[model samples]
Target chain A: MKSLIGWGVKPVDSHVNEKNDKAWTFKQKLFLGLTPGQYLGQALRNPFNWILGIIFAVGLPLIAYRYFFGLGAVTHASNDYPWGLFLGFGLFVMVPLSASGFMLGTTVEIFGRHDFEPIERLALLNGLLGYFFAVVYLLIDLGQPWRLPYPMFVSFGPAAVLFLVAWHVATYLSVQVAEVSVSFFEWIGWLGGKRFIRRIAIGLTVSGIILSTLHQGALGALFNYAPGKVHPLWYSPFQWIHFFCSSIPAGLCMVIVVSTIVKKTMAWRCDSNFSDNLDRCTLGLAKGASLALITYLVIKLIGIAHDNEWGYLATGWGAWFLLEMAVGVVLPIILFAYAIRHQVVKVARLGAMITVLGIALNRLNTALIAFNWQLYQEIPHIFEVIIAVTIFAIYIVVYRFILYRLPILYSWKAQPEEALAAEAVRPAPIRTTPSPAGAMYRKID
Target chain B: MSGISRRRFLAASVAGCAATTLAGPRKALASGTFSGYPDGMGVLVDLTRCVGCRSCEAACNKEQKLPAPDRPFDDMSVFDETFHDGKQKRRPDENAYTVVNRYNPEGGAPVYRKVQCNHCNEPACLSSCFVNAYTKTEEGAVVYNSKVCVGCRTCMVACPFHVPAYSYSSSLDPVIKKCIFCYDTRLKNGLPPACVDICPQEALTFGKRKDLIKIGHQRIETHPGRYVARLYGEKELGGTSWMYLAPVAFDQVGFDPTPGNEPIINNVKDFLGTVPMVLAIWPAMFTGFHLLAKKQKGHDDHEHDAEQQQGEDGGEQ
Candidate 1:
């Protein structure tokens, strides 16, 4: 009668029995079978939480102070450099990285790449958390956060590229919520809800593709509003294409990176199916990422050529630009290719980490560093950096909380006997009709 | 549900049509060449007569009723002000709508350039505002409505001249601060802005924009040695309501000599054009991919069954 629920997947009956398990409730499920004091102790003992504690100590007050005392209190508040790090990192960088939901949704659902099914839920969850947190970052940065709905309800500047970005991002957030909700429904044992979602799943995914395509490109086109202000090297008529194409690899590699982190740090949460096939999934994602990286590099070069910005390459900015390409784009391409050929997942993981860094660097450079190339660089204020890091920490906490509980990296257990029945009724070798995803919802004996 | 009531359906269709027609004209201006409204007012700034006096800045401050400056307007020492960026002289900010910066050319005398909103014909701030908070008035003023503004600061970034500043010190209510060409009080009443009216040396000329352009060229042609032949704002960013003629080259006096003739919005049209294409094509394209995958799965299932039968027969033999 000891708890079967520890740090791994918890089925419906894992904490519930006909006699005594009925006493265990949502509170027990939330606490992961540990007492409240034990949970607090476990959290405090982790060194990472201590670092987060220190960040929130300084940063939470700063955020409150920013609202009370105004943006000028914590920021240098230069009108010339209006965007700063809040947008450069949070909106611009995070949006592209969160493209994972649509990417994996397409791979597994649309393309019928069922090998990718194990990681699809994880990708969807990562995408949802990233976008939700990006909005949180935006609220901190906006001067009038309460009026965030102005673009949608009060007034419409349909001509503006930012107007497109605003509307699409809002709609896409809902799409991501619905897509990730399937896992949430499964975890909560709502078979009916999961089935309803599965029925409209194709409609949701197609809209996701449309929304992701427009908004990811729209973020780049926002810079087109500042023609001479952005450096010639970074600004192009094809800036939209550059952002959209690079996001493909960024999205794919982000999935690999998140899965790798989950496997290394919290293997107990992963079922054997996930742990066993993770290496193969990593290589498959790396193949997609390498193809995207190569396409991104060529399009970037084409952008430079179309603009005839070859002369800027001789300057210091051009050298920095080349270094970003070499490290972020070229090196990842070579390493991913090498890893795929040699079947070295460790090397592919390293490539993914570098790619994430590279994408972050590219967004920062375009938004802050290379902006106003003639003027001096705008170094983000100390408080601004702290708030950014704090928001990112909150993102990680929410991400981990969900991954630990949801049927993302592992399958959820149905009723005790039904779960066993499902195992017994696994699809025969020659039987293939409805997708595994659809078949997963079949009634078991 | 009974299909929408007939009255409701008719009302909805009428409202939809009305909205489309109302939005139609605005969409037309988002692309193509936009020379300003024909009767738009303009200012001609003759830099030779400015004489480094800060009267325009003082006049602007008084008219706008902005917060008092750290240094008094009469303080001549303000001419030597330096910004946090090591070399930048004061540009316009929240407190003052206009500023006069003294740019001293190497061997010549000091030239004072008064900086404020240029009131662009095709204003980037107006185009980039997602909330439609900015309006390019027929009076040739780029005006803002702070009530609808979400203050995302895209306007500040989009301004080529860096004219708009935000009231970042106001926690409860922060808004963009920029010169509106005194549209509500002065320009609409057929009177010049306070700064133009108070110019001691007739340095700032107020007239029709077309007339000012002709006047600007006449002065340059008449006194070629005293002026650079180029008029600063006539063709910059698709022309502006304010034009300047300076003795020194425009860059020496802090004007972007080559800001290009195309307006900022033109640079974004190509990307915007592709948006509808993507919306139209992606659904069909991806749905086709899904169908193809389903078809391939069917083919694979057939092969698997055939192979199983062949293996069963071989085992029996």
Candidate 2:
């Protein structure tokens, strides 16, 4: 892709190809205005594709084998350890990281922070795909994958914490899809749908906040069902709050981490707006993450204090818990504070990377590692690990595919035809002086 | 006293009272703490009387029509079966609904503890099920409807006793297999389960749950030296239908001793209670924030919608 960009082959970012007056067809957009040969050439040239290929080669068969032979064929999910990497990593970890959607939605839409606007679509897309794949991971983990909607449409156990998760995740996934659809609508040239989404954007963002709050907490509350099973160091009376609070930083840091990755790997796909605003956004997001990390740390301590679990802090597990706190929560706090103060986006980016890992470790520790601490530790079956990795790899591929084409990383410039049509309709002759974005489009056209 | 009168002396708690409080108490029985059904049948298993014979295991297998086990019920070596690096004793699995393991408590003769579903007043398995697959019946049996089971095994994760087992090998139709207390054929028919019917030594005594608690206390009182003072399931995790009279301390015989009397669902109620509040409060609160923030936007976002058009035009180059 970088090589193609260097070759002066521009990727599609508008309804029409700039050099030609003709509108870009759907096929042309899908291939990023490149011919089939050039598209294939880039895909095959990237070594990441080969790595994904190898993973799919091994993991796809195991996944099929699991469905054919049953979950026992691929997972070490026994009666005692019912959830393995599937729920521990795929659902628990992915869901929190994907919280980037709601956090950014709240900042940009709900809080009207236009400064954070540049990466809002990327964050929303990140949330949508992360959750979509989390559900994909869930389907693989569920015994009756076909009955995933049974809780919603069939039999509803409205009281169970999991029922809340099922309903919220399902609903939030819709909210996120609607939120991210602005970019999709722009790409597909569906101006009406984009306008409609814009009108109801507030409703969607509000609902996103409501659903994300309950469900992110609900995932933690699922562990509340097994109070005795989860080790006290990780367990808490406020487990849900701990989960909810930590997710704020997790979500913010995730945006920073993802934007950094985008800036590093796919700079060509990013327009000036995204590439230019990313550093400021990283620092701004780091500030939010630092505050969240501090809140999470204090509450984590309070959770232990409220439960009088200070005794467990001296044990090996306590040491491990402190390690998580020191690295995941505390270290990120210090680094973020320093980075924000110094305006060192590179340092903030490093802190964001650590915060993401810290959140993942926290969820994994609660869900799998420290779970059933009284019982012998169960290692997930090899096939289960491979399948989890494969699904994550697929998530990355889908994420890249969207970033490569969607008008998410760049402003979709108005076609010359649309600009002329707007000009013809506007009797006042551009009296509004078009917002910078509109002006950019007019200039390009 | 008759069983009905004995219920006044003790409560027959089978599931948490908190369970009904969250969802508008469709099964609300008189609204206070929901003890088990008044006439709910229960089993009092005297561990001193259990002879380590696996007859109950055999009877459960036959009654449930479960698949044959890896070892025959008559095989005493199955008693030595340990798993997960010998950290786990033989537990009920897809093939077996109950198993008797020999526990040699310190300074005591080998005590045999029959491990099965405690059939809690608020069974964690029943409470955690998202599909409403589990039902704590008026008969005091916590039964499952496998037709609706999603195979998430959340019940398995939620069961503090670690009782529910999954049949993960069945590709198209894996379901949780556990001791349902013979709810289908026997307990619902007002008869003792097959395990109780087949116990040779009367180690398993079946009667109304209140009567069983009374009888359990009487045995402890009448034979002070013969049993531990505590009834294993009484007030345990909001109490279980199947109570135990162990010869040694419960933990010495492989029971989780410190599991508090609060039902597992109580631990989750804090979170569930917040759901309604968040659903109700967040929309208004966040919308209010949006309005406040939008009010400060100074203009009705004449400053580029940003997502679609993030450029300020920066004085329009």
- Best DockQ among the predictions, by candidate number: 1
For model 1, which pairs clash? none
| Residue pairs in collision within model 2 | A436-B312, A436-B313, B12-B36, B14-B120, B14-B121, B14-B122, B15-B121, B15-B122, B16-B122
Fnat for each model = 0.64, 0.69
- TM-scores for all candidates: the values are 0.90, 0.92
| Model 2 agreement with the true structure over A1-445: per-residue lDDT tens digits | 8888889999998777878777899999999999999999999998989999999999999899999999998999888899999999999999999999999988887787777888888899989998999999999999999999898778867778888788778878877888888888778866556655665666677677777888899899899898888999888878888899988998888888888888888999887777777887889899888988998889988888888989999999999999999999899899998998898989999999999999999999999999999998979999999999999999999999999988888888654544545634322111222126422221111
By DockQ thresholds, what CAPRI class is model 2?
Answer: acceptable
Classify candidate 1 by CAPRI docking class.
acceptable
Q: Candidate 2 — which residues are off by over 4 angstroms?
A: A416-445, B1-32, B299-317
Highest lDDT against the true fold, candidate = 2
Q: With candidate 2 superimposed using the best TM-score fit, by how many Å does residue A198's alpha carbon deviate from the native? A: 0.3
DockQ score of the complex predicted as candidate 2: 0.33
Candidate 1 stretches with Cα past 4 Å from truth are A1-24, A416-445, B1-29, B299-317
lDDT of 1 by residue, A1-445 (tens): 0123444424332324334535346676576556677667667767888998888898889889889998887776589899988899999999989989999999876786777777888888878887898899889888999999998789999888888887788878887888888877656655445644554566677778878888899999999888878898888888888899888888888888899888877776777767877888899999999999999999989989898889999999999999999999999999999999999999999999999989989988999999988877788889989989889988988898887677687665453444333543432222223223323222111
